[model samples]
Target chain A: MNLVGSFFGSSIGRKIIMALTGVILIGFVVGHLVGNLQIFQHPDHINGYAQFLHQLGPLLWVARIGLIAAALLHIWAATVLTLENKRARGGDYGFKHTIQATFASRAMRWTGVIVLAFLVYHLAHFTLGVVQTETFKETAPLNHYVMQNDYRVAGFTVVKAGTDVANVHSMVILGFQHKVVALFYIVAVGLLSLHLLHGFNSLFQSLGLRNAKWSWLLHKAALALCVVYFLGNLAIPGAVLAGKLRPQTAKVAATAQR
Target chain B: MTLRVWRQAGPKALGQFKDYAAKDLNSNMSFLEMLDVVNDELTLKGEVPIAFAHDCREGICGTCSLTINGKPHGPGKGIATCQTYMRSFHDGDIIVVEPFRAAAFPLIKDLVVDRTSFDKIMQAGGFITARAGSAPEANAAPVPKGVSDLAMDAAQCIGCGACVAACKNASAMLFVSAKVGHLGLLPQGQAERDRRVLAMVHTMDEEGFGNCTNQYECSAACPKTISHDFIARMNRDYLGATLRSAFQPEAASSDGGGA
Candidate 1:
């Protein structure tokens, strides 16, 4: 193996790669959450935000390619490490007892798989505008909604700004109105949070950045972050289900779909 | 007391738990001594006594190993099997005994395993050079007290395989890293520091031991309570050494060998 290949081929080296890629994905998750939370603002804010991203064009694809690479590498490292771990353990001990390993630590592989599955569905639902076609803002005959500057007036297609854009603000609210979709999102994000619970802390140890001194802080911080991320994700679907969140102009689009 | 011992005739033989009555045991006797009493009776009866390993019987040697009731060294912290007294177990308690299990440390008999895989890792790390002349003054190579203490902590590893037995993945990273850290901390260990960490880790992976997941089970099972910090230290050193060797090929060879 060449020097670079040899470096990444070893056990520790594989883990180092996993940690690096994990950090990239983690950054994306946080950034994605921040963008999604703008749903609570005026319809114009989030719609304009979506419009701005659409304008990024090629840059967005570059970011997407980087993210896809990170996810693939992360899965690759995890598979190699998990299989090696199973083989090294060999036969089962007659009596097995776990002392200090947490449930989150042991559940990494299972949780990761679930999160990846969720990512696929999430992309289908929002990015491709394929799943839940009825609620997709960019769907035919009901795609355009005028952006209104007013926050509380409820953005309508006949509003003051009159600039046509995909109604991303209502699409999110309308999609979550489906109980199954909302529950699935909640469950999937919950598993992703569990995956992050162990992963966020483990990334530090894999990179040798964590020792006894900062271990406690990193552990607590990772837990807090996972909980916060999970709750923030949960709140959106939860609010829509509870009728606290409503589409500013989905009535017209919903009737037009019928 | 009833002893549920894992009995295997040989490496290829199938193993099973065979119960033996260990009667009239004194709580004051160590776990090994109780086993001795049982073995004496078995020898008199013309039966094969339980096969196990022991040496100094002191915790320092790391020679004695057993998984007493699923925990290495039997339900105590920072002490080996030899140090576990019968007082810890109540009368008539069923104590289960088994050997340390791992792909690398293949079973030798009922309770003994081949741990020479550790020796292979040590050989890969190699030895530090020391002059054969009269003892140099301690001040000649001044090592900070804290640094020396840390080295001693890593040096406390007795090459015991309990860490492997305790780890869920059967990883030997803690053991390998201990050897790397103990020497790498001192001035004497610097010349081969890069090569040592790199080769030792390479050998460790080749040995079929699992990778560390930072669970710290090895540290918890360690008789000497060696910190898991050594693993992290070794990781940092390994990364730096790999990068340095690639960038400065000349330094890698002069230091002893290319990683």
Candidate 2:
């Protein structure tokens, strides 16, 4: 493995991993954003959506694990390849720069790290319920609630209801409602967009599909997708904070035994 | 007029740019011809003249390599330094000349870096491995004219380090692509096509050349105006070869060393 390590670390190797894995991750990101966008449709729609994912049983967990593994592999390879790239130039100066490449291609490593940080914070605040502060506030008021011949404290807010003890929806709302946190989300999404723009173009280059005519157009498509995802995700928190969004209400139904 | 030129005593020695004043130089002389005049004066004074590389004074051979006034092969498209005329510069112009400064092309003396990695890449490409039999009639191998023309066009790459020098990342993709395409164009070179691309690209990485981010400086600085389109072709070939190798899982790896 050590002997042939150089062969695997070449530009060609980097391109192969980048292209094959890039398409997979892009598909996942698009689907994930679309799924996340379900919040605007109806209030209880998100809960039902979450329930559908939960009902997948072991397959849901399998998908989660697979995503994490793929993300890690992609990041790891990118970091190694970037380091190798830096080491190749023996500290020299030149007046003329390569004019064909774009800024996104240049800042891929930095943007990638920022996106990784966003992912970790996102998972922690929403999935782990580590920081359940004053953000997840109750909007609906009720004097008392009766359920199954028993009285219980009830609020519009969702608690940690999943198998993982995570109140993801509440966390998302709380995090976005804060002005500073919302700003961070906006910036992070911007950086992510930049990363994706270059990444999408370079993905084609790595795949050896550098057709001059259509390559730029592909870059545009990638940029548009990134913007759509960013804006779509950003709108949820922005609307929630603006008081335009409220907790979804469920209608009571008569049971057969009633 | 004095020109400040980068002079490296040897590979492992500390080097600096030295200025030499030529009191009188012919305005009609070629840039390199002026250098010869300087060398003659230095020899008369029992001093070592500045060393650089040049062969065919014509523009065809890419041997006369230099970064003149910060441009590879002395500022212009489709030309080497040897082909550049002194008329391009004013008599008092302070010219700063230096050899190619790439780790992959370490300086052996004053202005010559060891560009043998190029030759090694060509060797790995198996460019000279075909059987020496009777020449097949040109019509028998009537490749599509477009492919044949493009292949012939790419075959014009002279193994010069200008592309590496001009690249900000010091990528050697342009040079390697030319080699990969030279063989990949014809049917005779088809047998080892997969192996050739894989080997040459691997050697490029091992030699510490940077990745091709599709920065077209290599093409711009090329004396032959070698199109970056060839790079795209090389990349496609490399990916196809790698995928084929993966599916077949054969012992198809080649054992060759660098230039």
Deviation in Å, model 1, residue B203 alpha carbon: 0.3
- Number of backbone collisions per candidate: 0, 2
Q: Candidate 1's residue-wise lDDT over A1-258, tens digit each? A: 356775568988888899999999999999898888989888787787777677679998999999999999999988998899999987778878777888988888889999899999999999898898877778754477777663222343323365788888788887898899999999999999998989999888878888898899998999999999999999899999999888776565466447
lDDT of 2 at B217: 76
The digit string of per-residue lDDT tens for model 1 on B41-81 reads 99999999999999988889998999888887888899999
The stretch of ten residues in a row with the least summed lDDT in candidate 1 chain B is B249-258
**What are the fnat scores of the candidates, in the order listed?**
0.62, 0.50
For candidate 2, the docking band is: acceptable
lDDT of each: 0.87, 0.71
> Candidate 2's residue-wise lDDT over A1-258, tens digit each?
122342355676765666667777777877877777866764334544554566678999898887877787687667766666567667565334443456777677788889889888766655553543433222111111121111112533222332232223444554576677777777887788788787777677667776666766886787788788778867887787787665432221111012
